[model samples]
Target chain A: MQPFTYERPADVAAALAAIGKPGAKFLGGGTNLLDLMKVDAETPQHLVDVSRLPLAQISDEEGGLRIGATVTNSDLAGDPRVRERYPVLSRAVLNGASGQLRNQATTGGNLLQRTRCYYFYDPSMPCNKRVPGSGCSALKGYNRIHAVLGASDACIAVHPSDMAVALAVLDAEVEVQSASGQRRIKIADFHRLPEAAPEKDTILGNGELITAVILPPAPPGGQIYRKVRDRASYDFALVSVAAVVETEGDRIRSARIAMGGVAHKPWRAFEAERRLAGAVLSDDAFAAAGEAAVKGAVGRGHNDFKIPLAARTVARALTDAAAQKKA
Target chain B: MRNTSVTRRGLFGGGAALGATLQSGSALAQSPPPGAGAPPVDVSLKVNGAQHELRLDPRTTLLDALREHLALTGTKKGCDHGQCGACTVLIDGIRKNSCLNLALSCDDLEITTIEGLGREEALHPVQTAFVEHDGFQCGFCTPGQICSAVGMLAELKRGLPSAVTPELAAAAMEVAETEVRERMSGNICRCAAYPNIVAAILDAAGKA
Candidate 1:
C-alpha cells in the first residue's frame, strides 16, 4: 500500500472540506479501499477518516428508518426494526461477507465498493474499470463473473453488493453532503451501468459524502432475499434475488424485484414487477415474471449459465416470498 | 506499560543493539530504513491491556503493528488481505480482520488479540475446547479461529442472526451445528479440520 496522509474529521463539513482536493478519499471502512490500495489498484494520496464521525445512528424517520452512513453492516443487520420490518435487507446483509468483514464494513462503503472483477484487482491486466479507456479483459477473458445484463462494449463488470439489491427493491434514498450543499439520490439512480465509464460506479459527484440511507415505509408484503453462490457460505453470489410480493386473496396485488450478480448495478426487474401486478399467484405466473425479469439479458460465453440461473432464482424467491406469513 | 513511546529511529537502533547483544540476525534487523518512504505518523494502540505509542508508516496494517512493532506475534498474518481470518482481532469487542485495518485508523481503540485472551497456565475456554476436540492440525490458523470463536459467541449471545437462521425476525436463536458452521465460515483451515472445529465451537458455545 502506498503511504498517505490521514485525517479524522469530527464533522461532516470538515470531512467534505478535507476531501475536496484531488487524490483524496473519505475512508469509512477500509475493507475495500485498503485492499485496493495494497494491490495498487487505488492510490489515494490523502484519506479523510469519516468512520469515527457521528453518523453511526439508526433513527426512525416519519414512517421509515434513516440509517447513518457509517453504521457497520453488523449493526444495520442486527437492528430490531430492520430485522422485523425489512427482513430482506437483514438477510441480504447476512448473506454477504463473513462475520469479520461485515463487522468492519460500513453502509456507505458497501454501496461504493469496487467490483470484484479479477481484472480490476490485477494492475497488470487491462481493465477499463480500473483505468478508463485502457481496455476490458473481462470482455473476452475469463468472463464467468462478468455482467450478463445492461452491459456495454466498454465494460462488463458487475456490482458485487447484496445490500444494494435489497435497497433497490425497498426504494431507498441516499443522502449525500458536498461542499456546495446536500442532495438525495434515489437508490435506483444511484448506481450506473458500465456504459462508457465503468470507472464511475455511481452518480455521486467528487467529494460528496454519503450521510445516510433513508428507507421508506416497508412495502406491505413478505420480503425475501435469496443468494445463490458456489459455496453455501462466505462467497460472492453467482446470482441473487430480492423480492417483495403482496398477495390479495389469490392474486398478486403488488410486487417489486431486483437482482444482483447479473448486471453493472442492482438490476431492478421493473418489467417483472409490472407483469406480476394483479396476476393470479401461481407457478405459471411466477415463471412468467421470472422470464420477464431477464427479458433483455445478454450473456458472455463463460457466464451464459447465469441467465437461466437468474431466472430460476427469481421464480424461487417469489414463490417462497408469497408463501411467507406476513407480519 | 502505558504510553511507552518508540520512534522509528529508536526502534531500529534498539533492534540493532539487541541483535548485537544476541549476535544473531533478527527480523527487525532487516527492516527498511526510517527515511525510505512516507513520514512516520504517531499512533497509539491499546492492545491487550497495555497502551504503546509508536510512530509507523501510515500504510502499516494493524496485523503488522501487532506482530512486528509491539512483538505480539500471536495474531498471525495469513493472506495479508481480508480473505483469510488469520489476522482476526477484537476491536471494541467486535471481531475484524486486522490485515484490512490500518494501524493509524485504529489509534486509541481497544484491540484484543489472541495473546490477550488467556495466560499459558490458564487458557481461555474456547482455547481449551479446541485442544480437547483436536480442532486443528498444523495450528497455523488456530489463533484467528480462537479469537473469532470468542467473538462469534458474543454475537450469538446478543441474538445476532446468521445466513442460515430460519427466521430473521426471531428474538433469539439457538446455537446449532449448522449455525456454528455458517458463523465460522470466515476462518479457513486448509487442513480441512472443519468437523473438529465445528464440534469444538459447539462444545464451547454450550459452556459460554
Candidate 2:
C-alpha cells in the first residue's frame, strides 16, 4: 500500500471538506479499499476515515428503515426489523463474504466495491475498469465471472454485491451528501452499466459521501434471496436472485425481482416482474417469468452458462417466495 | 528442557531485535517503501489488555502493526489480504481480518489477538477443545481459527444468523455443525483439518 495521510473527521461536513484534495477517498470499514491498496490497485494520497463517524445508526423512518452508510454488514443483517420485514435483504447480506468480513464491511463500501474480476485485480493485466481506454482483457480472456447483462464492448465486469441486488428489488433510495448539497438517487439509477466507462462504477459524483440508504415499506409478500456459488460459503455468486412475490390465492398480485453476478449492476428483472403480476402462480408461469428476466442477456464465451443459470435462479427464488407465508 | 529454554530465549531475542528496528523508524520498517509519502503518525493501540503508543506509517495494516511493531506473532499473516483469516482479531468484540484493517484506522480500539485469548496454564475453552479434537496438523492457521471460533461463538450466543440458517426471521438459531462450518468459512485451512476443526468448535460450543 502506498503511503497516505489518514484523517478521522468529526462530522460529515468535515469529511466532505477533507476529501476535496486530489487522490482522496472516504475510508469506510476499509475492507475493499485497503485490500485493493495492498495490491496497488487503489493508491490514494489521503484517506478520510468515515468509519468512526456518527453514520452507524439504523433508524426507523416513516413506515420504513433508514440505514446509515457506515452500518456494518453484520449489524444490518442482524437487525431485527430487517430480518423480520426485509428478510431478503438480511439473507443477501449473510450470503455474502464471511463472518469476519461482514463485520468490517460497511453498507456504502459494499455498494462501492469494485468488481472481483481477476483481470482488474492484477495490475499486470490490461483492464479497462482499472485504467479506462487501456483495453479490456475480460472481453476475450478468462471471463467465467464476467457479465451476461448490461455489458458493453468496453467491459464485461459484474457488480460483485449481493446486498445491492436485494436493495434493487426493495426499491431502496440512496441518500448522498456533497460539498454542494444533498440528493437521493433511486437504487436502480445508482449503479451504472459498463458502457464506455467501467472505471466509474456508480453515478456517485466525486467526493459525494453516501449518508444513508432509505428502504421503503416492505412489500406485502414473501421475500427470498437465493444465491448459487461455486461453494456453499465465502465465494462470490455465480448467479443470485432476490425476489418478492405477493400471491392472491392462486394468482400473483405483484412481483419484484433482481439478479446478481449477471450484470454490471444488480439486474432488476422489470420485464419478469411485469409478466408475473396478475398471472396465475404455477410452474409454467414462473418459468416464463424467468425467461422474460433474461430476455436480452448476452453471455460471453466462458460465461454462457450464467445466462441459463441466472434464469433458473430467478424461477427458483420466485417459487420459494411464493411458497413462503406472506408477511 | 534445555532445548525448550533455548527456543524461548531465541524467540525473545528475535522479538527484541525486531522491536529495536521498529522503534528506530528506519525505512526498513515501512515495507515496500512509502516513496516520499506522508510522515509517520502516532497511534495508540490497546491490545491484549496492554496499551502501546507507537508511530507507524499510515499504510501499515493492523496485522503488520501487531506482528512487526508489537511482535505479536500469534496473529499470522497468511495472504496479507482479506482472503485468508490468518490475521483474524477481535476489534470492539467483533471478529475482523486484521490484514484488511489499517493500523491507523484501529487507533484506540480494543484489539484481542490469539496471545490475549489464553495463557499456557489456563487455556481458553476453545483452545482446549482444539487440542482434544486434534483440530490442526501443521497448526499455521490455528491462531486465527481459534480467535474466529471464539468470536463466532459470541455471535451465535447473541442469536446472530448465518447463511445456512433455515429461517431468517427466527428469533434464535441452533449452533449445528453446518452453522459452524458456514460461519468459519473465512478462515482457510490449507491442511484440510476441517473435520477436526468443526468437531472442536462443536465441542467448545456445547461447553460454552
Candidate 3:
C-alpha cells in the first residue's frame, strides 16, 4: 500500500473543506478504498477520515428515510425502520460483501465502490478503466464477471453493487455535499456508464462528498432483490435483479425494475417496467418483461451466459414480488 | 476525482504512542519516511483492554497493526484483500476485516481480537462450541470465523435479518440452517469444515 497521511476530520465542514484538495479522499469505512490502495490502484496523498463525522444517523423523514453516509452496511441492514419500510434496500445490502466487510462498509462507500473486474483490479493487466487508452484486457480475456449491457469500447466492467439496484427501483435520492454546497441526485443518475470514462464511477466532482441517501416512501407493492451467483455466498453476482410490483388482482398496476452485475450502472429495466403495467400477472408476462429488460444486451464471449441468466433472474424477481402476500 | 494532494484531521492520542512503538519488534520507529509515499505519523490504538500508541506509516492496516506493530499475532492475514475473512476482528464490538482497515482511521475505537475473545480456562461460548464440534482443520481461518460468528450472533440477537430471512420485519428472527450458512458465508474455510463450523456456531448459540 502507498504510504499516506490520514486525518480524522472533526466535522462535515472540516471534512468537506479538507477533502477537495488534489489527492485527498474522504475515508468512509475503508472496506473498498483500503483494498484498492493495497493493490496500488488508487493512491491518495491523504485520506480524510470522515468515519467519525457525525454522518452515521438514519432518520425518518416525511414519508421516507434519510440514511447518513457513514452508516455501516450492517447498521443499515439491521435498522428496523429500514427493514420494515424499505425491505428491498435492506435485502440488497445484506446480499452484498461478507459479515465483517458489511460491518465496516458505509453507505457512501458502498455507493462509491468500484467494479470487481478481474482485469481492473489486476495492476499488471492493461485495463482501459484503470489506465485510459492503455487497453482492455477483459475485452478478449477472462471476463466472466464483466458487463453484458451498456458496455462501450472503452470498457466493459460491471458496477458491482446490489444496494444501488434496489435504490434505483425505490427511486431514492443521494444527498451530496461539496465546496459549492449541497445537492440531491436521483439514485438512477448517481452512477454512470463506462462509455469513455470507466475510471470515473459517479458524477460527484472532486471534493464532493455523499452525506446521505433519501429513500422515497416504499411503493405499494411486493419488493424483492434476487442475486444469482456461482456460490451461495460471498460471491459477486452474475446477474441480480431488484423488482417491485403492485398488482391489481391478476394484472400488474405498476412496477419498477433494475438489475446489477449486468452494466456499468444499476441497469434500470424501464422497458420491463413499461411492459408490466396493466399486463396480466402471469409467467409468460414476466418472462416477456424479463426479455424486455435485456433487449439490447450484448454478451461478451465469456459472459454470454449472463444474457439469458439476467432475463431469468429478472422474471424470478418479478414472480417473487408478485407472489408476496400483503399483510 | 483525479488524484491530488490534500490533508485531513487526525485524532491524536497523547502519551501511549511512544511506548507502543518501542514495544513492536519491527522497530517501525525507525521508518524515516525517507523515500516515496508519506512519512510515519504518531498513532494511538486501544486493543482489547490495553492502549498502545505508536508512530506508524499511515497506510498500516489495523490487521498489520495487531499482527505486526503490537505483536498480537492471533489475527491472521489471509488474502490481505477483503475477499477472505482471515483478518476479521471486532472494532467497537463490530466485526470488521482488519486487513481492509487503516490503523489511523480506527483512532479512539476499541478493537477486540482473538486474544481478547477467550482463554483456555474459560473460552467464549463460540470458541468452546468450535472445539466441541471440531470446527476447524488447519486453523488458519479459525480466528476470523470465530470473530465473525460472534458478531453474527449479536446481529441476529438484535433482530437483524439476512437474505434468507423471509420477513424482514419479524422480531427475533430464528436461526435456521440456511440463515447460519448465509450469515457465515463471509468466512471461507478451505478445509471444508463448513458443516462442522455451522454446527459449532449453532451449538454455541444454543440454536442447534
DockQ of 1: 0.44
- Per-residue C-alpha lDDT of model 2 across residues A57-163, encoded as one tens digit per residue: 99999899999999999999999999999999999999999899999999999999999998888777888989888999988899999899999999999999999
lDDT accuracy of residue B139 in candidate 3: 99
Candidate 3 chain A: 10-residue stretch with minimal lDDT? A1-10
Off by over 4 Å in 1: B1-35
- DockQ, each predicted model: 0.44, 0.50, 0.41
Model 3 TM-score relative to the real fold? 0.92
Q: Indicate whether candidate 1 or candidate 3 has the larger lDDT.
A: 1
Q: What are the per-residue Cα lDDT tens digits for candidate 1 across A176-204?
A: 99999999999999999989998999999
Question: Model 1 chain B, poorest ten-residue lDDT window?
Answer: B24-33
Q: What is the TM-score of each candidate against the true structure?
A: 0.94, 0.94, 0.92
Error of 2 at A180 (Å): 1.4
Clashes (backbone N, CA, C under 3 Å), per candidate, total 0, 0, 9
As for candidate 3, its clashing pairs are A7-B9, A8-B9, A8-B10, A22-B4, A22-B5, A23-B4, A23-B5, B17-B53, B17-B54
Q: Could you tell me how far off, in angstroms, the CA of residue B184 lies in candidate 3 after the best superposition?
A: 1.2
**Pairing residues by index, what is the TM-score of model 1?**
0.94
